[model samples]
Target chain A: MSTIEKNVPGTRELADLVREQEEELAHLRARLAEWERTYDATPQRDALFSTSSGAEVRPLYTELDREGSDPGNDLSLPGEFPFTRGPYPTMYRTRLWTMRQFAGFATAEETNERYKYLLAHGQTGLSVAFDFPTLMGYDADHARSLGEVGVCGVAISSLDDMERLFVGIPLDQVSVSMTINGPAIILFCFYVAAAERQGISAEVLRGTVQNDILKEYQAQHAWVFPPEPALRCIIDMFEWCSENTPNYNPISISGYHIREAGSTAVQELAFTLRNGFEYVERGIARGLDVDSFAPRLSFFFDIHNDFFEEIAKLRAARRIWARRMRDVYGAKKPESWRLRTHAQTAGVSLTAQQAENNIVRVAYQAMAAALGGTQSLHTNSMDETLALPTEKAVRIALRTQQVLAFESGVTNTIDPLAGSYYVESLTDLLEREALDMFDEIDALGGVVPAIEQGWFQGEIAASAMRQQREIESGGRVVVGVNHFMEGSEKIEIDRLKIDESVERLQVARMAELRASRDSARVDQTLAALRHASSGAQNLVPAILDCARASCTLYEIRHAMEEVFGSYKEPVFF
Target chain B: MSESIRKIRVLVAKPGLDGHDRGAKVIAAAFRDAGFEVIYTGLHQTPEMIVSAAVQEDVDVVAMSVLSGAHLTLFPRVKALLDDAGADHVLLTGGGIISEDDMAALDEQGIGKLFGPGTPTTAAIDYIREWFSTHEAV
Candidate 1:
């Protein structure tokens, strides 16, 4: 203190300045208190003033609210450590987020034509939506796949279907994101084999397979094997892709389904980030460097109706992930610290009543995703609540992203709302809440154990029940649902009906594939897969051989099931 | 004669490969809170399994949630199975991403009233109570 006083000429001045500022701050606090009293005295609407996550929103937010937050450290510049502002320096200034519409239905050939249509209409990337049978690791002709073939998404059972899915589309030129879990590894092998058939090597391929399995057990419920074996397969992909396909993201640690399955925003952010960290820990446990696979690890989040909260969740996600990677996991690479994310507008928020309003909801959510620094975005179609989106509806959904990227001035700057006191406070709150949840999860012996104990599912179901109750009890207002009543308003929007013959066609195709392909090769590859499943060898290569031999999705799953066993969820309400 | 009123037993199930169970679970919980005995069959339930569970549980209502657009097939199949199992009196009612046209189509096939998105859990609860009161010996 003596040395500082001696060296600094304005020491006394500094003290005086601090005192004056303190007095001024006191006066401002007094005035603010008076203002709050006045505001409180005024009549207000009898509604819950809170975010969708039930976080209370005050009438005003100022510097007083951001008291303990160290702005410079908490929010460094974009592309810096603890990347709260954005992941990259010039986020949308250099290039806009990829407009990837998740589209698939009926047969492979039909979906291929739709992909071409989407591409021609200015879509940036291809996001494949597999049908239920394919997603559940069943062949189209399987008895379980009877009426479900091509009902939800495209049915891709073999490498032939995967090849037909991208007939003329160049794999090297297009980035494909496949939304398949449960049998994600097998489908990924089928995709790799399909690319190889097109003469595209694994090294040159770039895309993401939504190989997230933890969320399946926790929320989505599309699980094949138990947690241990499913995680082993995931770690196998992480190791295999680290060397074979460095550019491809082997897993998309998704909170989209978690939120869609009815979790709050903070829960989605925390659970998704926790799942990502679990993958990291697993990869490291498998003896791979954190920087090796962590860099390629990507995230998928759901953008709900709470605009500011959704944006804040993304910001907090980046910050928490960055700090965890660098400080917790002790990663050395900047890429390892960066949390790249793809966001989709919430499908649960859409309503069948006044379906057109969903377009606006999706548009706002898209803006939130853009403002939140998403690397990619998928906006939900208005007609999605009723059925699969029609072509026109999907086009409009894509156009929403286009308008946000082009017309919306939000892209003109990186993290335009970074310094906003409200956003910063919300981000801090979400981060703190998520950190607390992480501790609770740790107390439960981590993600897998927590899922096994049904903690995650219970939390999600409880939150979902609360939100449903809020909507029903008029605590929350869902337009055209609980509040606005358009009596006798018939839904006139054009609906897309999938022909039942699509199922029969897929069945016949599966039968034809069985009769034509080398039966001996299929049997041999499947046998090898089964054998490899029992060993410590990476299962990707074995699965790839099966895909090349035209083994059906179920055959590969069945072979692994012999060793891995199956996951039957603990049924509860 | 003092007669004991039978509590409406409901078997809430998810049919086909649809994994979305928020609706099913919510409805199940709501039915329970509304004083009904609820039995939930978790995800990936086949029609045969659902009907067998309904018959085994001897539930008055077999509410199935099918969001995979497999409702057109799943509902009719479950209904026919229940009929074959001699449990045709059980109500086949549930909700999902179902359209009015499809709802009407299913209703014509003797399926109970189907709910849609944004439908209050109370609507289903009240509908079931009304149906049970009218159909069952009260």
Candidate 2:
């Protein structure tokens, strides 16, 4: 009861007061309608402004919008079940999120210097970006790697390069995240061998290998083996890592590449969570307990331009994942119910024109990631839309995250925008939309079959087409490109150029490593790997043996491909 | 339709492991909207697979994309394969994260024009249409 009701001392007087307020509201509504009729609204291009995911944004929200949703029951405290507030009770209060910048270019040695530089300048962790050759499982000397080695990212052919990548930085001290998918297992083995050489055991090592082959088929298109054996390889990693490296995440189910492939936020959430569920089911099908592997599973998301929508997507993702893991999968542990994520600003949102504007774009996206309670973040450099970022550009990107951590008052409270009418409505809307998509995927017989049928690709392509059409039709105003008509912007900043000599140096290094390593031992280990691939035994240990014997990445990959066969994506209109 | 307005058949191929297909798919849709029959060879195509698909499909143009920085090697290899298979009349064009010098060198080596990242999809569509119009009798 309000103070007025207490003072009235009767139910009749309170009802009379409510009647008077209703009359006043009715008069106010009439006056507002009359004023709106007389007011000349400004001309707009469209009748309704909607989000990228097609949710219409209303001009005003009120108590009516929040009437049905119960905040006390749903919006639980941080670190509690259904972690909408956060994965931890004291999120950034205890410690700020890890500023793990993704950096690599040219060769391993050059990338090593960048890693050290980033580490010295407040970067909390490392994220390796492998070149096209390494990502596709090819040696630097392979014909397929010609003119490509050490161009887009660092090229690591053998364990020698992986060793050089973390020369001075101890692997046990800093967590590393590698962004290779198709040859992810081979790269993981190289990392393990490198750490072992550093006298760090596998049990103490911590990091994530983006061993997400499903997304490779869905969007990234960087897989070596077919889906059946590829999934088997992933399950094998899950089983092995559960026993060997307790702190390491065997797979970071990724939706960053999916969003970059032009998916909407809802699609990114639905498809990514579906992929994670498929991984869990695969582990269970392989006779592993759900709690054994689900807790170690992590997520990587792309925080895009829509600030509140991105935050709500993250929040909805956590709630849905928590409910699904507990109710459907019967997970008992709280850790299994939590969704720990690492987010990166959308590279697709960066613009080449007026490249400096990207700095502001990245800062906003980073803030959204923090507000969404990400455990780690990567801010894209301003010049990333053009090429691999130069040192200065990367530093600015890292500094963007740093400024948000230090200056932004967002960290003062967890889920600061949790109670807003707009946010709660959007979060529930996103959850319902994502659940509908999950039903559609389930009707399609699951994620793998859907991938084979090209459903995900078609959906992403259609979304991308709609966005492109909107931009071309002037319905969407991307600042530097469509709006703000000015003279042709000349690029004043220095761009990073990869000299041809970097390729030469890398090829020379490959030759030297080849000449020094024992060819017989490499052959023997590769033969064993090929033999093991034909049987039911796990290939991780065999691949690790090859890594120890100095077999290059392509060698182990080729051994498996000879048995499992290479994947060819189906065409879709 | 008039006999002079023959339907142009174009083959869009991704001949490398680079999964950046937003540009490739956009161009495919643009060509379809521009009234061309587009056969998109999906990802991870070698030079031989792409050339064989071009010859088998008898495409008028083979527009490939490789953002893996292997354009210098992949483009020349595709051009040579097309020449060897006697499908040399098929115009070969592509684009990626390539430098101006490399693009010029590839163009000089008989590959068609190379486009950078932000080039409009219509630009690619017009290039294929114009090349076929001029080389119709070849």
DockQ winner: 1
In order, candidate lDDTs are 0.92, 0.88
DockQ of each: 0.87, 0.56
Predicted structure with the largest TM-score when compared to the true one: 1
Lowest lDDT block of 10, candidate 1 chain A: A1-10
TM-score of candidate 1 chain A against the true chain A: 0.97
Tens-digit lDDT track of model 1 for B97-122: 88999999999999999998888999
Residue A82, candidate 2: alpha-carbon lDDT = 87
| lDDT (Cα, tens digit) per residue for candidate 2, span A384-495 | 7667898899999999998899988888888898888898889989999999999999999999999999999999989888887877666887877767747425555567
The runs of at least 3 residues in candidate 2 whose Cα sits more than 4 Å from the true structure, single-residue gaps closed, are A1-48, B1-3, B80-89, B99-110, B136-138
Backbone clashes in model 1, listed as residue pairs: none
Q: Report the C-alpha lDDT of model 1 over A1-573, residue by residue, as the tens digit.
A: 221234454888889978987898788899999998999899998988898888899889987887666777799889987899999988999999999999999999999999999999999999999999998899999999988898899999999999999999999999999999899999999999999999999998999999999999989988889999999999999999999999999999999999998899999989999999999999889899998899999999999999999999999999999999999999999999999999999999998888899999999999999999999999999999888889999999999998888898999999999879899999999999999999999999999999988999999999999999998898888888877777526687898889999999999998999999999999999999999999999999999999999999999999999999999898899
Model 2: what is its DockQ?
A: 0.56
Off by over 4 Å in 1: A1-17, B1-4
